[model samples]
Target chain A: MTTGNPGPTSGPVRSEFADDAEMTELVQMFVDELPERISQLNEAWNSADCQRLEHIAHQLKGASAGYGFSVVGEAAAQLEESVRQAEDNLSAATRQFDELVDLCRRATM
Target chain B: MQQQEQQPVLLLIDDSPSIHRLLGFKLKNEGLDFLAAFSGDEGLELAKSNQPSLILLDLNMPIMDGFETLHALKDDPETIEIPVIVLSGTTKPEEKVKAFELGAMDFVCKPFDIHELRVRINSAIRISRLMRMLELRAQIDGLTGLWNRAHFNERMGTELEAAQRGESEIALALCDLDKFKNLNDTFGHPAGDAVLQGFAAVLNAELRSYDIACRYGGEEFAIILPDTNLEQARSVCERVRVKISERVWPNYPKLSATASFGLTHIGADGRTDASAFVDAADTALYAAKEGGRNQVKVYSELPEAGDGPAKLALAS
Candidate 1:
C-alpha cells in the first residue's frame, strides 16, 4: 500500500518562484519575519486581542503566496475569516484559532 | 519615440491593510495602478472621485460591506456604469449569485491568485471600455460626426443646471445653412451632403473642445458654449460662419455654404431655464435669417422665443 506524503506548502509548493531571485529575496524576508509575526499573533490571541490577530492573519494571507508559502497564506486566510465570524463567541473560536497557529508553526518548521 | 501606455486603474475596497499591502506588492510591477480603500464608504468615495477602470470589492468588510457598497455604486448615476468584481473569502454559490444579482461583473475568491486577479481585472476593464465606446457611438451623429439631438438635449439640461449653480454666463447658438434645400434640389443631394460635411468641419475647427456642437436637425446645428458671454459667443459664431463661407465643398468645388447664426447669452445673474434658453437661441437664429441671412443675430432683439415670425421651416 502506498501513502501520499503530506505536502510542504511552506517549502517548494511551486517552483515557478524558485528561480525568481526577487521572489526568493521576499521568501527570505518572510522566513526572517515569521517568528516575530507568530509571536505577535500569540500575544494577540493570549490577550483576547481579536482585532490584532485578525489583522496579522489578514496580512499573512496577502503576503505568504507572494513569498512562495501558499499553505501559510491559506492558513492565515482561514484564521482571519474565523476571527471575523467569531467576534461574539470567543470560547468557540479558540479551537479554530489554535489549530491555525499550529498549522502556521508546522509549515514554517 | 515611445508612446506612454495608460495603465488600467483598479480600485480595491477591503478592510484589511494586509490585503492592500499584498495586492500592492504583487501588482505594483504589473503595469496597473492600484487604488486601495479600507472600507466600503471610503471605496465608494474613491470610486466616485477616481473613476477607476475596474473595482475589486471585498464582500466582507466593516460598516458598509461589499454588497451594500455595490448597491450604492450601481444606483449612483456617475458610478452605475463602472464594472465591479466581488472578492470574497467564501466560495458559497449563494454569495456569488447575490453578487451577480447586485451588478457585479465577476467574482473572485481570496486569497487571490495573482494571475487570476490580473486576468479578471483586465477582462472587466476591457468590457467597461467597450461599453463606453458603444454608448459614445449611440450619442454621436453619423453624418456630421457631431453629438446627436438627444445627447445635446441631455447635456444642455445638465450644463444649464451647472451654470445656475456656478452663476456663470453661458451662450447657446442655433445655426442654419442658407439655401440648403435649393442646393440639394439643384446640385443633387450629394452636393448638399458635401457642403454639410464641410460646414461641420469648419464648426469643429472653430469651436472649443468643451463646446457642445450638435447636428440638431437637417441643415441645422446647435452649439452650447459654457462660460462664454454674448460677445464671446458672437466671436465664435462669426469665426465658424466665416470658415463655412470660405470652405470649398468637396464635390461642388465652386459652391460655398453660408450659415446664419442665432445666439443668446444666459447672464450671470439672469434666470432663464433650459427650455427658454434653447427657444431664445432658435429665435435668434430666426432673426439671423430675417436679417438677410449669413449673419449672427442676438436673441435679445428678436421677438418672443418660439413666437418669432420666421418659422424654422422657412429659415433656409
Candidate 2:
C-alpha cells in the first residue's frame, strides 16, 4: 500500500505558530477534538461511509500540514484521493487511512 | 465614516479544525477579527449576518462544499461584495479554476506559508477597502460629506419599508436656508457655498450617527430620523437652525443665516411612500417660510399655524 514510507508518527509537528501562545490554544483544541474525530474516522471506514471518509480525509489533508502535522497531511492526502476516486485497492485505502489516523494519534502540539 | 474605524473582519469557513486554528493564528497579527465556521452552511449564515471583509474558504467541505458556499455567497446581494479566498489541499488546477469561476478571490494551498497568506490577506483587504472607499465616495455629498440626494433617496426607500415592518415612527424634515439668495447676492457664490458647508456642519454636529442628512438641492437639505417622533424631530431641527444662526462665518464674520424646517412623522397608519412623505415635509417647510422664516413647523401643525403667529415667533 504505502511505497515504503508510512510518514512520521512521532514528536512535535513544527509550524510557524509553534512559538505563539494563541496557537497553543488551537493546539489544545485539536487535542481535545482528536478522540472524537478519530472515532468518526474509524466508524466511517468500517461502515463504508464513503462520503464521510472522503470528508474527513479531505479535512485532515487540508488542515494537518497547516497545523504542522506534515506526516498526517501526507497520509490523509493519499486516503482522500483514494476515497474520492472510489479506489478499487481496498488494502491501499486501509493502509493510508490507518497511517493518517496513526499520525494524528501520535501528533504533539 | 464610523465604520471606517473597525478592523476588517475575516471569516474562516473550513470544516477542518486545524485549518481554522492555523488560519486564525497565522492571520492574527493582521489586525482583523476572525470568525470561524466548521461547515459550509454555518459559513454562509455567518457571512450573511456579519458581512465580513474577507472570507478564507476551504474547497472540500461537507454537505455544502467550498464551491457551493462560494456560489451561495456570490448569489446573495448582502454577501456578494465580500471577497473569498479558497483553500485547496490537492493542488488541483481545475478545482482552483472552478473556485475562481465561482467567485473566489484567491487560493491558499494545503501547506500554506504564513507570510504568503498574510500578504494575500493584506492585499485582498487593501483592494476591498479601496473599492469600499470608492463606493462610499459615490454616495457622499462632495461639499458636505453627508449622504448625497441620490443615496438618501435610495436609503429612504429601505428605511420606510423597515419602519413599516417594525411599526416604528420615522420623522422626515425638509430644511431650507432662509433668504439664501439674498445672502448669496450680498456675499457672493463662494460665501454662499461656505454658508452651505457651514450649515451642513451644524446639521452633522446636531444629528445622530444613524440620522440621514442630505443636500436635497441648492441651499436646501433633508433629514431622516428613524425611531423619532414629531416633537423630537422638531427639537432637533430647531437646534440645527439655532446652531446655524449662532455660528460666525469665517469669511463673512458679520453674516448670520437662518434655516426653516418642515417636519412630519410616518405614524402607525403606515404611509409608506417616499415621494408623498418627502412632499408632505416640503409642504410643511413652505409653511415655515410663509409663517415668517426661520421657524420649524410640523405638517400637522400647519392648519392651526396662522392662529398663533405670536406663539410661533416666541418659539422661534
lDDT of 2 by residue, B1-316 (tens): 6575788899998777677767777777789998989899999999999989999988777678788899999999999999998877768788888888988889888768778889999999999889989999998889877788889889888888898788888889999999999998999998999998998889879998889999988888999999887778888998998898899987788799999999877664455477767777887899899989988988767775444322322132
DockQ of 2: 0.56
Q: Give per-residue lDDT, candidate 2, residue A100.
A: 72
**Residue-wise lDDT of candidate 1 within A12-109, one digit each (tens)?**
23423667765665555556666777799889988888888887787677656656667667767778888888886666677667755665565431
lDDT score at residue B226, model 2, on the 0-100 scale:
94
Docking class of 1: acceptable
Clashing pairs in 2: none
DockQ for all models, in order?
A: 0.37, 0.56
Runs in model 2 lying further than 4 Å from the true structure: A1-49, A67-72, A86-89, A92-109, B75-78, B164-170, B188-190, B208-210, B227-232, B264-266, B270-272, B284-292, B297-316
lDDT of 1 by residue, B1-316 (tens): 1124478888989886656766777777767888989899999999999988889898877578789999999999999999999988778999999999999999988767889988888788888888978888898888888888999889998998898789888889999999999888889988888887788888888898888899999999999999988889999999998888888665676776899999887677666667877877777888889889999998775656446432331232
Q: List residue ranges in candidate 1 displaced over 4 A.
A: A1-16, A19-22, A49-67, A77-99, A106-109, B1-5, B15-18, B21-30, B39-42, B62-64, B68-78, B185-188, B303-316
